[model samples]
Target: MIQFKNLTLRRGVKELILNATLTLNPGSKAGLTGANGAGKSSLFALLMGQLHADQGEALLPPHWVVAHVAQETPALAVSAIDYVLDGDRELRELEARLAEAERDNDGVAIGHLHAELARIDAWSARSRAARLLSGLGFANDAIEREVASFSGGWRMRLNLAQALMCRSDLLLLDEPTNHLDLETVLWLEDWLKGYPGTLLMISHDRDFLDSVCSHIVELANQTLTLYTGNYSQFETLRAEKLARQQGDFERQQRQIAHLESFITRFKAKATKARQAQSRIKALEKLERIAPAHVHSPFDFHFETPESLPNPLLRLDAISAGYGGKPVLDNLSLSIESGSRIGLLGVNGAGKSTLVKLLAGELAPLRGERIEAQMLKVGYFSQHQLETLREDDTPLGHMQRLAPDAREQVLRTFLGGFNFHGDAALGPVGPMSGGEKARLALALIVWTRPNLLLLDEPTNHLDLEMRHALTLALQDFAGALLVVSHDRSLLEATTDTFWLVGDGAAKPFDGDLEDYRQWRLARQAEALRPSSDDTAAPNRKEQKRQEAELRQRMSQQKKPLLARLAKLEKSIELLTTEKAGLEAFMASEEAYADDNRARLADSAKRQGEASAELERLEEEWLALQEEIEALENGYPQQ
Candidate 1:
């Protein structure tokens, strides 16, 4: 168990946590969340024994082995699997001892060392390391490749794999899903759920937290508060507590009203896909969380597009790749005005390439790309952060973007992204990744793009900024095509899902759940046994197997699809009723001096209808995907 008693943690003269007392019992998985610079990492440091509490103690059992992802991995020529195996300190030490004993011809020492190795199951170390690497999205060949050959993101994953290799009593992970794709994120989430240890994770990814964390510990305002349950549960409980206060009542109501109207809809969306599940849950709880930040530091939204052409862009018979090799062949897709789409595929399946083509950063190797003359793209990707002039202040960057605009106007705009006071005027060289990312987005948004192409836009954003961005995108009156691992954002914003793989880009008929099952089936098939003989099977035997499989699948899908249709129809009817009630409630007539009673009744009915609509929609989407999985299988990427 890890415990902090009267913990007064500080950095320099600035107090972070004051007299905070919290205890995490052994095998209890918890999530630590707070605003950026709110001492989440500092608290982690306290537990790791790297930072001493200013006044009290941060304690762990003396014999407990603690594991955390390394912040940096040195450039090493060793195989990635071997590097991961190095995390097991005891294993490495024992092996070193065994080698020395063998060289010294000490029979007794060698026998004892081998016995210890067997007791610890050291023989399976390589296999365990390999599993971790693969789960983190490293292929078998890549696992055997030199560690230094990989990129920075790959190295970070290697570090994570190494941390997971340790059979520790306590595991600490900070932004563990930072560089992961949706598939890898799901694998990691499932893996963490099954981890038999005390886990404390610091993450801005709400869905990941909900999936793996049993409880949440919130750090804010120099206080540490413990909440039992996942992030959503914590938000609701906290909202209820905050609602009791006079200051938060009105704000809470507004948040609740928004949630009441959309919760059921978002909840339905959550069950539709793996990425959406987290975002949908977060959306449900945002009502409660919104009140906590009534005076939230960030408030921003995209400006309405100048012109929205019917087809914003179009690709015909495209063959796109690099170095004269095509990654996507005969790919054709169209982006229309008011479209909200999320691109989905496995890692290295050319999502980035497709985004690049859409943004006009990469030209198609062979094909025609027809763009609307009025098309104005606001593109954002990780590379944009690198392109920011380090010495320039946020204000300076914006000034250059709009040189003719008034300084006050630019300052006001920057403030919307929370670049206020000295922070806005300070040089960006010292800015953190979150700050840099915000600046990049602020610049892109300032352009008033009619077509937004975002690739992992929330990579370094905290939960608050992400929430703000989600709201902004919701109101964005332009076509949006986003590539992101943040489930909440995708679920809340995207109206459609596009599958980009198999050397083609195509509309995916089903939601995230369907894709997830397809991926799982694909993986299972890949791992399934291969035939020893290449001889063709008898036609009758093959035909019989195929027929039986089809019948079994159809039997399972038929009833589920019927339920799905029933739910969808119920949702549609309720949604239409709710929309009418909501519109009437919002009308000036309802809010007029003489119609207060009517307004109350209308609002109540609208809330009820929305809730029912959400419930049905959620059920429909989940069932629809479940049936789709049986009807449509995923091909290997």
Candidate 2:
């Protein structure tokens, strides 16, 4: 069990949780949610022992084993399964002792270690790791690949897998589904439901929360409120509470106003001075009830497109992919005006490729792509955030897009995206990812395109931003084609779904649940043994083949291992620097009014360092995979 008794947590000058008390019983699965910058991450930090509460007790059982996904994963050359298996610390420690005992020929110690291993079921650990990886969308071959041989997103999945592999009493997952595809999200939901440990996760995916959370813990207004039941239930209960709070607030205001009036008029009279003083004392003692605030800070709507042309874009038997290789082949699809479609696929299944092809960013290798006259396409992707000028402000970006628009007009428009006044004027370099995403969205909405091609548009968005976008999309008159893992957004905004798999894109006949079933069936089919295999390969022959393959792979491993060493050093340095920056930002002096410039500089440097670290890790992965391919006598990609 975990307990926060009158916990007061602060970051710099901002008080996040003030005198908040909550108890999470053992085996409780809760969803922690709040608006962006509402201290959800800070709370996780507190629970993980990375941060101490400013004033009060945050207690967990002394013997409880807590597990959390590491924020950074170095480009390690270890096989993915080994990395995941490392999560079982007890198992690893026991194995180490067993190896030492065997070296020393200590039969007693060896027997004890083997008995302990049996107790923990360590013999099946590898298979367990493989299954965890598979559930997170890793292929069987990928499970044997080096950890360095995966891109950032795949590495995130690996981190998640490692966290899940831990045999612990508590698990803390922050935005666990952010890097996942819809199929993987479904798999994770099912997995979490069966988890026996206490789980606290932070996520903007409402459907994921509703599916897995037994209780909802909301962080708002410097307080922690625990509501029984799922997120939908939390919303209903919160709304009703807010309604009552509003009524109470209004009544309190009237009573206070009357008290003030009585004190003001009668205080000047000599005979009534005693009564006036008594009233003043009463007023001073009155507890103030804060007003109920239900409105989301975000408010915006998509404007009508400049032109509405039927069949805005059409792909005729097109083959789309990178470097002339087709991930989606002979796919004929069309986007008509007012059509709302969601793209569903596993990671690397060409959802983004299809979006790029539709947005005119990719050239079809085999077929014709046709566009209606006066077609205006607005495309939004994670890449759009990178395209933003680091030195330019949000207002500056909008001004360049609409040079004729007035400055005040542009400022007002950006405000709708919550980039108000000084925030809109600040350089984009120091802004958070979610803020950058909002800016990109604002620019897209400003264009009033007849067709929208959004690829994972909700990636860095918070719940409020997601809700706002959902509402805007619902009211959008233009055709929309979206590739997102957010089931709530898909359910609210899209009328149809297209499943992208098996080198083809076709209309999915059912909703998200049906897509989940389709994915499970596909996975089952892939795992099923072939009927053509009449007999198993001879064990000696299989061993000989594996020996030969390993011998060849060992010859090519040296250079990749050297490069990995260098990458590890670079990653460590960058990680340390980033941590120092974070430490400074968390300090009280960093938030001082006079230290604003230094704070901004630290933030910008932190962002640059993180981006560079990601690039280096990605390059490391590519090089490692290339080495693997060469050893196997094949070309990567």
Candidate 3:
């Protein structure tokens, strides 16, 4: 368990947490969330002992091992698997001692170290490291590559894999999904859901938090508030709480009304794909959750395009890639004014290459790209963040775009992205990633382009900023093509999906869920055994063997299936009861003096139920993995 007792944390003159107390029990998965500069990372520092509290104390069990992803990864010559194995300090230490014992010819010491290694299951450490790397999107051969050979993002994935490799009781992750693709993000979710340790992660991805976190701790106004359930539940509860406050009520109502208006209007708009309907539903849900973010600093929308050109951009028989190699070949696609497309693929599968082609940043290796006479493209990518002049500020950048526009107009436009006062005037050199990203977005929106090509735009943005961006994109009457691991953003803004893989880019006739299923099936097929005998097997013998294997597997899974059913039922009952308790707690009546005792009881019961539910969920996940292994013909450990 981790505890903060009357903790007052300060970084220089600024106070982050003021007399905040929080207790996160063992094995509880918590999501740390707040605005960009809201001390979420500072709180993590407090737990990791990297920073001391200004007053009181932050405590963790003395024996518990803590692991966190490194902010920087040096260019190491060691193989990726070795770097990951180094995360297990105990294993590394024992192996060192064993080598020393061997050199000294000490049989007893060598035997003892081997026993300890077995106790820690160190023999399988490499395999475990490989699994982590695989889930993080490393190819099998890449796992054996030298760490120094990988790019920055791939190196970050190595850092993550190393952190996960550590057999720690407490794990702290900050923006774990930053460099991940959607498939990798989904894989990470499953891995985290099954993690047996206490996880405190900071992520802006709402869907990721909902899938992986059992609790959410929000830092706001120098206060820490712990909420039961996931991000969605926290948002709902917070919305209800804010709605009752006189100061916030008016603002909340206005935001809700604005979202409702958008939804009502957009519902009547014809869309080219079923995902458009999904986006509409997502927006409606966003309207319900709007109050939770009423206090967000960001408030901006794309300006209406001067012209709505049909087929804003077109690619014909394109072959796009770097150098002489074609990553995507023979691809033809058209982006119209109403095209709202989400790009889906594994990392390095030509999604970005396609975006580069559409953005006119990369010329097609072989083919033609046609653009409308009125085509105006607003392109954003992580690389663009680097292009910002360090000596210049947001105002200066905007001035470069519209030299004739008045400074006040530029300043006012920048304010919509929450770059105000000194933030707008200061050099971009000292700005945080989120601030720089906001500035980049402000610059793009000022162009009033009819086409937007955003690649992982939400990488450094917080939840509020992400929500604001989603809202703005929803209202933008232009074509949008986005590549992001943030499922919420993809679901809310895109009406179609294009799968970029197999050396080509093409329309994927399905939603994200379907893609997920397709990915799973693909993985299963890859894992299934393949024989190179070339000769066709006898059909009758193959059928008999398959039947026998199925019978055996069915018998083995029967008990596990029964247990899974029972666990599901138990989880359902507990969840319903917990919801009832939370509903009471959210009610104004729960705060009354007369109902204080009842409130306390309900709170206690809710905590217990949450813990129990977490336990059941973990077990259920383990069983699921076991079942999947069986179905895939892999032996469970």
Candidate 4:
């Protein structure tokens, strides 16, 4: 158990957590959440013994084994799995003792150490390490490579894997989802749910927190508050508490109403997914925390394009890939003004490749890519971060993007993204990844692109920025194609989904929740032990085969799935309409309005459309079942 009694913590003269008392019971999986500067990280530091409480006591049992992701990963020549195995210090020590005993010709000592190793299941340590790495999105080949060979993001995943490798009584993870794809996020969520430890994690991802956490612990207003249940539960409880305070409820209502407006506009892409509902509920919960962000430094939105061309982009029977090899074959997609699309697939399933193709970074090898002459594309990806000039400031970057824009106007826009004062003018080399990400996004928004090809744009973004991005995406009158792992972002912003698996970009007939189930099923099939007793596939062997199998199955049922997707899209519109009307009715203004004619008409239409939507949805589901059954059929053995 971890307990803090009237704790007051500070960094320098700034008070972080003040006069806070909280208790986390043993084996409690708790999420620590707050604004980026709201002392969440500082509290983790206190728990890790890197910081001291200024008053009272912060206590944990002395015998508790703590595991936390290292902020800095050492560049080592050791194999990544071996480096992860090193996280199990006891296992490493026992192995070392065993080696020494063998060298000394001490048979008795060697026997005892070997038995100890078996007790700890040391023989399968590599396999366990590989699973952790794989669950975090590392490929099997990457697992055996030297640690120093990976890039910063990949290295961060290794660090997370190392932390998970340790068998401990307490586990602390900070933003473990940042470097992950949707596939890995699902895998990690399942793993965390089964972890037998007192877990404390700092994450901006609301969906991840809700999935992994049993309790929500928020640090704000120099206080630590604990609530029962997950992030959604916490928001409800917090909203209720805040609703009683003067100005708090009003502030929350304003923000919620604003969010509801965007959500309504983008409902067609977001309504079917439960995660989007979670966000809507979360935003309604934001009605409780309005005071916290009343003056949030970040308040930027994308500018509407000067020209929104109909059918902003069109691809006809395209074959796209890298180095002359096709990753997407005979793939065709049309992007029109107001298209809100999300791409879903396994890793290396060509999600990014599709984005690159849309951005014209990769030319189609066999198909025609027709772009509207007025199409101004704003492309964002993790790789774009590397393209930013390290020596330039955020303002400098924006100036270069729009040379004709006024300096004061550009500075004001940068300030909206929280790049103000010296920070706005400082060199990018010293900026944090989050800061760099914000700058890259700022530049892209400055371009007023009518078509956006964003690949994992939320990778290094904080909750606030993610929220802003979601809102901006909703308001932008543009064609959007996004590849992201954030469920909240996907559910909130995208209206349609495209599967980038099997080297073909086709409309997917499901939502984010469905995608999670699909991914998990695929992973389970790939990982299941073979029935043949004599020749079981090794973990690495299974992963390699899994990738290949997904690739092989990518092109199957393209036509049927695409048609089903079209039908589902119609259902999406109906569902979105009903959901939006209900959302409006949930507001106080609907009941007021000086008159009730609009409310009556809305209620009448809602009743009319509800049954129609159900019929369309049912038809869509039956079609999906037929396609699935067909895909599953095979010749008798």
Candidate 5:
């Protein structure tokens, strides 16, 4: 557990956190959410003791261990397992002591060593380490791989796994989900949900927070405010609070205006002079609430040329790979103009390779790849920041991208993406992921290309910026080919889905939810217990025989079907109830009835029904898919 009391952190003249008081309870999962530069990461640093506050103090649990995983991982020349094993310093020391005791052959020392070994063994340290490593997406073989050979993303995962392996009293994670793939992220969500220790994480991942955190803490205006709910609930409550504050400020202004009017009108009157002066004094002494600073909205628009009649890109039986290991084999697909396509697949499923082929960065290993004539492509790769010159300022980068453009024009463009004033002159190398992504986007937009290829464009963007970018892409009249695993982003911005699987590309209608269901069904089929036997069956299975196996399987099918039916019924009932509530809540008369009590009740019921319906639907769909796969044989789509 950790607590902050009147903590004020400053970086030179700029105050980062002001008078912040917060507490992280034991076994509590807390998420810190705020706009960029709002001190979320700074608070994390303060909690980790990496940065000291200029004023006040942080009260921490006595001798409590804390493990921190920073956004950027340090480079190390070591094996991944060795790095993770380092997390258990006590266990390592115990092993060393035990070795010494065995060498000395002292009874007392051996007894102590045996006890220590037993304690370490009781903890199941090896299993815990393996679980943490696998949960963070390190394949069993990759655990022994040298850290230096891995990419930056994999290294970040290694660092995260190491932190998780520590199993400290408190975990401080900053943007922990940034480098994680969908599977690893899901694993982390489950792990954190059941995590017994205190967790204080700064994440822009809305879904992750909603799944794991019990409380949302926001850092804004140099202060921290705790909300007893997830990020979405916090957003709603914060908006309401701001509205109430605005209303109170307005009421005070009205009262002040009345007092000033009375003072101005009665200033020279002999009978009322004292009262007027008293009102003036009171008015002057009143403490005014500063209005909230509003962020300037960036109106982004991507212009696209006329749509091509045929597909802009076509892959004819193409195969791509690295070092002769096939990533894609005999893949064929066509991307049409004005199509908003989302590429969905598991990690290392050739999605990135496909993007490269579309971008013309890689040639097809076997077969033809073609692009339409006059097709101007603008791409934002996952590692697009690498393309930027570290020595150049933002303005300089933009200038290099558009050399013919005026300096004033370049500055204006950079400012639109929140890089203004001195920020535009800052070196690009130190910029955050969000800033770099925005800069890359700004450059892409300046080119005014009709074909856009985006690979995880929402990687580091905050929710607001993600929404803004989604809206911008929605309005753009161009062909979009995006590869991202963010469901919300894909659902909001994509109209078509391209599923890369089994060495081929398949197209699907609808959004990510549909694809998710399809993928889950496929996985269920793949994982379904099979009767294949390379050797003799075990005694337990042989005793059951084929008849008993069929009977058990049949019995299992019945409950699954019944559960599916119940879920369907629940979904239907909730749908009707939600609709009725929405109809009543939308009526103006409902608000006038008994102080809007009926409307309030209807709104609450609607929310509950909607949430329940979503849960039931997800379960129902998963069950139905599983049952269908069990009933029918597995067939490749």
Candidate 6:
């Protein structure tokens, strides 16, 4: 458990978080969210003791172990398993000490060593380490692979696995899902949901947060505001709060205007002078709540040209692969103007290969590929940042891309994508992945291409940024082809699904969720028991029973829907109660009543509310899964 009391953090003269008080209870899962550079990672660093607060205290339980996985990974060349196993450094040291004691044949030291070994063994450290490593996507073979050979993305996963292996009482993860593939991310979600340790993570993965976290802590305007429920619920509540604040501000403005008018009219009147003065004083003393500033004013507007009637790119009977191995064999696909297609597949399912083929970066083997005349294609590769000059500043890059543009205009453009002042002047090499992605996007928008090809465009973006990009794509008139694992982004941005599997490309008439459900069902079937026992029913009978179960699952949806609704209501109520309690606790007046009895009462209520919220959330998630299964049974409209 950890607590931050009256904490204030600043960079130079700019305050990041001010007067922030928050508690991370045992087994609590909290999400830190806000716009980019709102100090989400800074808050994590503050908790990790990597950065000290300018004021107040970060309190931790005595001897509580804490581990943090930062956004940027540290350089290491050790094997993945070796790196993860290093998390138990303390236990390793104890083991070494015990070995030395045994060699020395010292009775007292050996006795102490035996007890220490017992204590270390009591935690079942080895089993935990193995489980954590496996859960994070490190297989037996990958565990031995040198980390230096892995890509930056895989290295980040290695870092996460290492952090999780620590088995610390408190874990602080910054963008833990940034590099994870869909399956690994889901595995992590399950792990975190069932984890008994306290967790505070900064993640843009909505599904991950919705599955794992019960509380949302936002860093804004140099302060921390805690919200109940996950990211979606937080968004709903935040919008409502902002609306209420705006209304209150307008009402106050009207009251102040009337008071000013009265004061002006009654200044010389003896009878009304005192009342008018009193009203003036009250108006002057009123604390005006300023409207929240929009983080960036640069609207993202994609100017897509009118769709061409002809097909831009076509692949017929194609076989694509890497290093002499086939990934997609005998595949046929066509891309025409006005098509917004989403590629859905597992990590190694040839989706990226398919994109490369469409981009003309890879030549198809034993097939015909064609490109329409005057095809101006803008390809946003997964490694698009590699196109950027590491030594060049964002502004410099922009200016070079559009040399005729004025300096002020260039700076304004960069700022619109969240690169402001000195930030725009910083080298691209040092920028975060999200910043680089935004810069890449800004550059691409400048080119104004008619055919856009993107691979994982939402990789490093926050929810708002992702949504903004989705909107821009939705409005674009160009033929768009995107390969991404982000379900929501794909569903909202694309009109059709291009599934790259079974050694070919096939068109599916639905969103990514449809693809996901199809995959899940296939996986579930694959995991189902195979006929073996003599007493078991015949294969056809078994198939009939499975079909019946599927039918029953599809038909028995009403009770689950009702249960889902009830759970939603419970979640809403618990969220409201938690928010009220937090607001009350943050008030100065509440400190005056900080006696044992009052504190105990508040703590009891908080605990109850938290427990109830967690339970309801779990039930809600299960109901959602059931609904997803049922929805998969219906034909796509």
| Model 5, span 1-637: residue lDDT tens | 5778898876433577888888767887889887887777667766666566677888888878888874334346877887877776677788788788788887899898778778767358777877788667566556766765454456667778778877588888887877455656767888888877888898877777888888888888888888988878887888888888888888888989999999989999999999999999999899986554445445566766654545788889999865344568998888888888888776666677788889988777798988888788889874566677767888998877889989998888777787889999977755666777788898898888888899878877887777678788888787888876566667777788877767777887756556656755865686487776732456445445633544545665778656755665676777788767756654556657584777767767765675566545444534644553333211101
Which 10-residue window of candidate 1 scores lowest in summed lDDT? 628-637
Candidate 4 C-alpha lDDT tens digits along 1-637: 8999999876533577889999999989999988766788778878888666778999999999899998556558998999999899889999899889989999999999989999999999989998888788775566777886444456667888889999889999988887567888888889999999899998888899999899999888888888899988987887777656537656667767877776676656745556556668777555254343434568888777999889899999999764345778898878989999998876667777788888998878898999999999999976677788878888888888789989999889999999888888988765666787899888888888999999889876887788888888888888888988899989988899988777677788888888777877877897886787546457557667645644544455567657765875687688789867755654567668663887777777775676566445444534543443332211000
**Better candidate number, 5 or 6, judged by TM-score:** 5
Off by over 4 Å in 5: 70-79, 112-123, 256-277, 293-296, 323-326, 389-415, 420-430, 508-637
Per-residue error for 461 in candidate 1, Å, reads 0.4
Per residue, candidate 6 scores C-alpha lDDT tens digits across 1-637 of 6788999876433577788887767777899887776778667766666566678988888787888873334346776667777776677777788788889898899898778868767357656766676666554445665665443445567678778777588888887776455656766877788767888998887877887899898887777788989888998888888888888888888887888899999978999989988987898798988775534444676775644546888888888764345677888778888888887765556777788788888777669888888677788864566678878999999989999999998887777677889989987765666677899999988777778899878877778778778778889888999876566677777888877776877888665456557766876686577777853557567557545654665456668656765666677777888767645544445556445466556656865675566545444544554453333322100
- Write down the lDDT of every candidate, Cα atoms only: 0.81, 0.85, 0.82, 0.78, 0.73, 0.72
Candidate 2 lDDT score relative to the true structure: 0.85
- Candidate 3, residues 291-378, lDDT tens digits: the string is 2345778889998999998989889998876435567888887898889999998777777778888999988889999999999999
Could you tell me which 10 consecutive residues in candidate 6 have the lowest summed lDDT? 628-637
The regions of model 6 sitting more than 4 angstroms off are: 70-78, 106-128, 260-284, 293-298, 319-330, 363-366, 389-432, 446-448, 501-503, 507-637
User: What TM-score quantifies how close candidate 6 is to the native fold?
Assistant: 0.72
Better of 1 and 3 by lDDT: 3
Considering summed lDDT, which 10 consecutive residues are worst modelled in model 3? 628-637
TM-score of each: 0.76, 0.88, 0.76, 0.70, 0.75, 0.72
Top-TM-score structure, candidate number: 2
Alpha carbon deviation, residue 552, candidate 6 (Å): 54
Q: Scored by Cα lDDT, where does model 3 land?
A: 0.82
**Ranking of models by lDDT:** 2, 3, 1, 4, 5, 6
Clashes of each: 6, 0, 0, 3, 0, 0
Instruction: Return the TM-score for candidate 4, rounded to 2 decimals.
Output: 0.70
In candidate 1, what are the lDDT values of residues 384-441, reduced to their tens digit? Answer: 6767887889999998999999998999999999998888998876666788889999
